[model samples]
Structure formats: structure tokens, C-alpha cells
Target: MFQVALTGLLTGLALIIAVGAQNAFLLRQGIRGEQVLPIVLTCLLSDVVAITAGVFGLGIVLERWPSVLPVAQVLGGVYLIAFGVHAAMRAWRPGTLDAGDGTAMTTGRAIMLTLALTWLNPHFYLDAVLMLGTVANSFGADRWWFLAGTLVASVLWFFGLGFGARLLRGIFARPTAWRVLDSGIAVVMGTLGVGLLAH
Candidate 1:
């Protein structure tokens, strides 16, 4: 059980640490101090749904669907790379804000955007649902424990990312910081995309 839990935790953390489209968006929203909680919660919930599907043996079905995976990889990879580039551009060119009070997002819009970003990415299915599921499945009955541990990690990570960004709000007040963050995001996302395509 302990081994299973540790493995799940590590796997979850590894995947979450990657600078993907969803995460990039999350970070940007965080910096902007938008509807941070709603966006973060949606992302975390999406992960829970996908991870549950994978741990429940849906990953095996996805593995069997070769065409699905490739198409998804291609589309998702393209989206991620494009999103990265866009972020970089945003960083390069700071935009004037017409809205005040620091709230640029709404609950409905946040849910839709987060859901699309989190769910539409095939990489999410491949990495979190399928790959992580496969690892958990190897433990047989221990799979439940592994999944529980992983879910806990996910919750912790999402909350930290959402709320913790508040601590850095001051830094984001400067345009230079946005430039740096977006440029770094672009590099990371581009690298991840190229690597995925290579594989």
C-alpha cells in the first residue's frame, strides 16, 4: 500500500509539474487575479474525472484505439504549442486593461474555458488517465489506495497553484514579469510538444 501510494504521488506530481496549456492558462489567470478559484477547481475536477476513468480500466480501451490517440496527440500538441506561442507574445506585448477591480473572468466562462483546456487535451488522457492508471493497475487491489493518494496530491497541487499565486500578485503588477513568465511558458510548452511528437 505504501509503495502504491508513493508511486501514485510521484506520478501525479510529475505530470502536474509539466508546463502544459491548461497550466499555462492557469498561471496566467492567476497572475491576472481573475476567477482563480473557479478556474482552478474546474481544472482539478476535470483531472479527477479523467483520472477516475483511467483508473477504472478505460485506459485500456484508449490504448486499443490507436487512431484516437494519434489524432488527439496531434491536435492537442498543436494547441499546446500555439497556446505557448500566444502566451509568449502576450508577455512580449503587454495589453492595456479596460476593466478594473482585477476581475476579468466570470464563473460560467471560467468553467467552459477550464473544461475545454483540461478535457480537450488528449495528452491529459494519455498521461494522467492512461499512463498513471496503468501504473496503479499494476498493484491490483492496491490500485484504490494508489488512486486515493494521487487524488490527494492533485487537490493539493491545484489549490496551491490557485491560491498561492496571490502571494506573487505584486510581482505581476509589473509588465516585465509577465514577459518573463510568458516567454518561459512558451519555451516549456514548445519543448513538451516537440518531445511528444518525437515520441
Candidate 2:
């Protein structure tokens, strides 16, 4: 059980710890000191639901109905591209952290964007549902342990990222830093969006 859980943990981290849209958005929020707690919780709960669905059985349904992925791919791809454009705009003219040139990244909007990013992205579903599900199912009777391991990984990662990002607040005081971060986000989001579309 220990080894199996460890495997699950490592696997979850391998997939989760990357420069994805979700991570970038969360990092921005954390650094900006805006709705960090809710955003972190949103991420944590979303992962719980996704990984839980995968571990229990949703992967099988998705496998049998392979047609569902393409639809998700299109929708997700378009959304990602739009989001990337928004990031690019921000990069082009980054404002003061405290005053986003009157365009505040509010809590409600942030939460809604987080939901869209979480649900509309087919890549997320692929990783959490299909890939992780396939892996957890391999544990057979000990799949619960695997689930627990993955859950722990999600919890640790979201919490660490959301809170730990505050440590770099000092660097983001300059508008140039914001531009650089947003530029990176724009590139990543755009690339992923295009990949999804091409897929």
C-alpha cells in the first residue's frame, strides 16, 4: 500500500507540476494578492472531483465514448486561445498591481475564469480522468490507496503554489515583471490552445 500510494503521489506530481494555464493563473493571483484562498480552494476541490471521478470509474465511460473528447477539444481550444489573447493584452500594457488600470482582476471574475479553465480544458480531463484513471485502476483492490495518494498530492501542490507564490511578491512590484509573466502565460496558453485545436 505504501509503495502503491507513493507511486500515485509521484505520478500525480509529474502531471500536475508544470507550466500550464491553471498554474500560471494561480501564480498570478497569488503574486497579486487577490483571492488567493478561494482560488486555491477552487483548484484543490476541482482536482479532488476530477481525480476522484477518474479513480472511481469515469475513465471507463470516456473510453467507451471516445467521441466526447473531440467536442471538448474544440471548445477548450477556442477558450484557451481567447484567454491567451487576454493575457497578451495584459502583457502589452501591464498596470500597477494595486490598480490594474481600473480593470481589476476581481474575485468573482477570477473564480469564473478558474472554472472555465478547469472544465473547458480537454487536456485537464485527459490527465485527470483518462490517464490517472488508467493508472489508479491498475492498483486493483488497492486503488483507494492510490486515490488517497493523488489527493494528497493535489492538496499539497495547490496549497504550496497558492501560498508560496506570495514569497515572490517583492519581485513582481515592477511592471516589467508583470509583463514578462503575462507574456509567458500568453505563450503557454496560446500553444496549448493551438495544440488542442490541432489534435
Candidate 3:
């Protein structure tokens, strides 16, 4: 059980730590100090629900439906590419990272955007549902242990990302820092997008 849990924990971290729309949005919110708690909670809860669904049985359905994964891949790749371009543009004209510098987004608006970002992306389904589920189910009776590990990973990552960003406040105070960060985001997104399409 411990070994299975460790596998799940590591796998979950590997998947979740990648560059994606959800993580990008979370980072932005964390840096801007805008609705951090709600956004983090939304992401964490969404992951939990998706991962649970996958581990229990949804993964089998996804695997059986051969066509669904490809379609999702195409859509996800396109969306990721577009998002990468947008991030590149932001990097080109980087902005200050002060709390007041960000657009005034209400908690409601933030939650709505969070939902859209989390659910609308096909990659979310691929990772949280198909991939994670299939992997978890492979553990047989110990799958629940794996699920628990993944749950821990999700909690740690969301909280770490949302709160840990505060530590970077000093570095992100400058426009150059924002540029570097956004540029890195752009590269990661674009590369991942291309990888998805290629696969």
C-alpha cells in the first residue's frame, strides 16, 4: 500500500506540475493576490472529483471509447497553442506585479473563470480522468491507496503553488521577472501543445 501510494503521489506530481491552463491561472492569481483561496480550493476540489471518477470506473469508459482521446487531444493542443501565444504576448509587454496592478476581478468572476479553465480544457480530462484513472486502477485492490496519494499530491501542490507564490513577491516585483516567468510559461505551453498534437 505504501509503495502504491508513493507511485500515485509521484505520478500525480509529475502530471499536475506540468504547464497547463489551470496551473497558469493559479499562478497568476497567486501572484496578484486575487481570490487565491477560492481559486486554489476550486482547482483542488476539481482535481479530487476528476481523479476519483477516473480511479473508480470512468477511466475504463474512456479507454474503451477509442475515439474520444484523439478528439480531446486535438482540441487540447489547439487551446494550449492559443494560450501559449497569449502568454508570449504578455511576456513581450510585461507588467508590474504589484497587488493593485492586476485587473479588478471579483471572487465570483474568479470562480467562474476557474471553473472554465479547469473543466473546459480537454487536457484536464485526459490527465485527471483517463491517464490517472487507468494508472490507479492497475493497482487492483490497492488503488484506493494510490488515490489517497494522488489526493495528497493535489492538496500539496495547490496550496504550495497558491501560498508559495508569496515568497516570490520580492522577485516578481520587477517587470523583468514577469517577463521571464511569462516567457517560460509560453515555451512550456507551446511545447506541450505540440507534443499533444504529435502524439
Best by lDDT: 2
lDDT per residue (tens digit) for residues 1-199 in model 2: 9999998999999999999888988988888777888888888889999999998899999999999989988998898899899989988986633323313667788788888888888878899998999899999999888888988999899889988998988888788888898889999999989999999
Better of 1 and 2 by lDDT: 2
lDDT of 3 by residue, 1-199 (tens): 9999999999999999976778887887788777899999999999999999998898788778868878767876777787789879988876533445445878888888788667756778888998899999889999999999999999999999998887878877788888888888788778777877998
Score every model by TM-score: 0.85, 0.94, 0.82
Candidate with maximal TM-score: 2
What's the residue-level lDDT of 170 in candidate 3? 80
* Candidate-wise lDDT, in order: 0.77, 0.86, 0.84
Ranking of all candidate structures by their TM-score, best first? 2, 1, 3
| Predicted structure 3, TM vs. truth | 0.82
Pull out the clashing pairs in model 1: none
- How close to the true structure is residue 12 of candidate 1, measured as C-alpha lDDT? 89
RMSD after CA superposition, every candidate: 2.6, 2.0, 2.6
